[model samples]
Target: MKIEIWSDVMCPFCYIGKNNFEKALEKLPFKDEVEVEWKSFQLDPTLHPDETKTTFEYFKEKKGVPETQARQMIGQVSQMGKNSGIEFNFENAIITNTFSAHKLLHLAKKYNIADKMEEALFIAHFIDGKNVGNIDTLIALAESLGIDKNGAQQALTSEEFNDDVQKDFSEAKNHGISGVPFFILNGKYSVSGAQPVEFFTGALQQTYDETVSPLKSLSGNENSCDADGCSI
Candidate 1:
């Protein structure tokens, strides 16, 4: 089975859902056969690096909410992250553009370390509060992940893999995917949001069954959630 996941590096649910999906795969009979491909998606394409404010401030400003409310929402998401063994320290997370971060993931794909790249970026942004949009920070991350830092810098500085990133966005639009953390199973079944582990397990079982049973498809498309405060 092939699983394609569309996610942004900064999306908390993307990280959580990925964890849940992996756990589900572990329970499946064909887990070893599963190929997961992480596709790039930017929640905030127009957002620039803002050093004066944290992500909490940016959240409050973007949604026109009180600072307290933003904290509460972050708290809820943090608690959810904890359920999946993620320690979310969003209190001081630096808000920055993630287009470069996504590009780095694309570059990591060549080195067969895209999954590690995703985890590293999420940990840096959510726990360490590192600025993923900074070219220097991204290069450092690439170096740590065993990818060529100089090559990563070249790609980030130029238009390398940019079209590949844009193509993912266009495909998401064409598929009516207005969300992050969206999972496509065998390029047919779609699961949205950070659903329960059983939901993913059931999806895996059902997809696997269809391949063995030779059944016809009847159900239509599924709905999903968009990124908070950003258009998908």
Candidate 2:
């Protein structure tokens, strides 16, 4: 089974959802049989890379939300994140474009390190409050994950993976995905937001039940005898 997740590195819920989903995966019976693919989706694409504003600042200026309301909103998310074992430092979160980080994810996907890259990006932005939009920061983070920094840098500076990232965005829009951390399980079951662990566990069980098929003879019908009838 393939599980594709459309998310953004800067989205707080995406980080929380990652942890929650991983927790659920840990207990899933068919977890080893599942393949997870991380897709790109920018919550705020128009943001500039050199943005110096924090999350609260951006939300306040862009949405006209007051400072206290923004803090409350972030506090709620922070509490939710803590429940998932993620320590979110929203106070220091730098609001910037995630395009570079998303591109790096496409690059990492080539080396089968997409999940590692995604987690690194999330940690950089949410916990460490580093600017994921920065090329050097991205390279450093990738290096820490054992990913080739030179390769990552080349992919970052050039237009490489740009279209790949955009394609992910386009597909998300086509699917009417208006939010981050959207999960598509086996291309059949869709889960939105950072749902509870039990919810994901249930979805995993349901998908597994619906997909696992009993052995059948495809070439021809086998001779069988039952109380009701006998067939050849």
Candidate 3:
């Protein structure tokens, strides 16, 4: 079975959904048969690398919400993240463009370390509060994950993966995906957002069964992020 996930590094729910999906996949007998691909999607493409702000400020401005509401929304996500063993430090998170980070992900895919690159990027943005948009930061992240430093740097500098990233965007549009952390299983079934482990386990079982049997239904909720904002 093949699983293609469309997500952005900056989306909190993407990290949460990844963890949930991983936990569910681990319990399956056919885990080894599953090929997971991480596709890039940017929730805030208009952001600039040079522009820096804390997540609180970014949320306030982007949603035109008051400070209390912004903090409350972030608190909800932070609490939800804890359920998946993630420690989200929204206070220190730096808001910036993720185009370069997505480019690095394509480079990581070449080396079969795209999963590690995705996790490292999530940790850098949500936990360590690193500027993922910076070239040095992305190069260092790629190197830390065993990708060749010069190769990663050259890819980013030369925009080698720009088309790959754009292709992901186009695919998302075709699929009517306006949110991060969208999962496509075997190119048939999909589950949106950071659903519980049980939901993923059930979906996986149904999808897997459908491979040998007939098609079945998959159910889940959508707690995803898009251009407007994240759903609470």
Candidate 4:
């Protein structure tokens, strides 16, 4: 069974969903058989490079929410992150264009280190508050995962992998995905949001059974909805 996740690195719920999915996999009976793919999805493609906006400031200015309310929301997200063994430091988080980071992820995927890179990028942005949008930081993180630093730097500097990243984003749009953390199981069943571990575990089991038995329909009689934020 293969699971493709379309998510953004800056998305807090996506990180939570990733952790939850991993936990579910740990307990899964066929954990080793399952293949996971991390696809790219940018929350804001038009984000500028020179923009030095803090997450708090960005939310406040873009959403017109007061600073206090934004801080409260960040606190809530931070606590939720703590529950998943993630230390979220909202104070140091700086919002930047993630297109380059997504490109690096594509390179990591080619090296079979996509999952590790995803986790590291999430930690860099949300926990350590490192500038994941920067090429230097991305290359350093990739090198830490045994990826060739020179290759990573060249890939980052060049336009290579840009088309792959864009293709994934375009495919997500074609699937009507308007949000991060979207999960597509075996290209049949789809789940959205940071659902509970039980949900993911059940999905994996169902996917596994369907893959093993071709006579079974994964969705059964359930109606599949478009990606307009509908419940599964």
lDDT of 3 by residue, 21-101 (tens): 999999999899899999989999898778887887887788688889988888999999999999999988999999999
Rank by TM-score (best first) = 2, 3, 4, 1
lDDT of each: 0.86, 0.88, 0.92, 0.89
Report clash pairs, candidate 1.
none
Worst 10 residues of 3 by lDDT: 212-221
Say which prediction, candidate 2 or candidate 3, comes out ahead on lDDT: 3
> Which has the higher TM-score value, candidate number 3 or candidate number 4?
3
Using Cα atoms with residue i matched to residue i, what is each candidate's TM-score against the true structure? 0.88, 0.91, 0.90, 0.89
Sort all candidates by lDDT, best to worst: 3, 4, 2, 1
Score residue 133 of candidate 3 by CA lDDT.
Answer: 93
lDDT of 2 by residue, 1-232 (tens): 8899999988888888999898999997778898999999988877777766788789888889999998888889889998989999988888888899998899888888899889988888888989888999989987887778788789999998999999999999999999989999888889999998988899887887777645555665458777878787
Off by over 4 Å in 4: 213-232
Question: Candidate 4, residues 14-93: lDDT per residue as tens digits?
Answer: 99999999999999778988899999999987778656578878898777988899999889988888887778888989
- Clashes per model (N, Cα, C within 3 A): 0, 0, 0, 0
> Which regions of candidate 1 fall more than 4 Å away from where they truly are?
49-52, 212-232
Off by over 4 Å in 3: 212-232
Off by over 4 Å in 2: 213-232
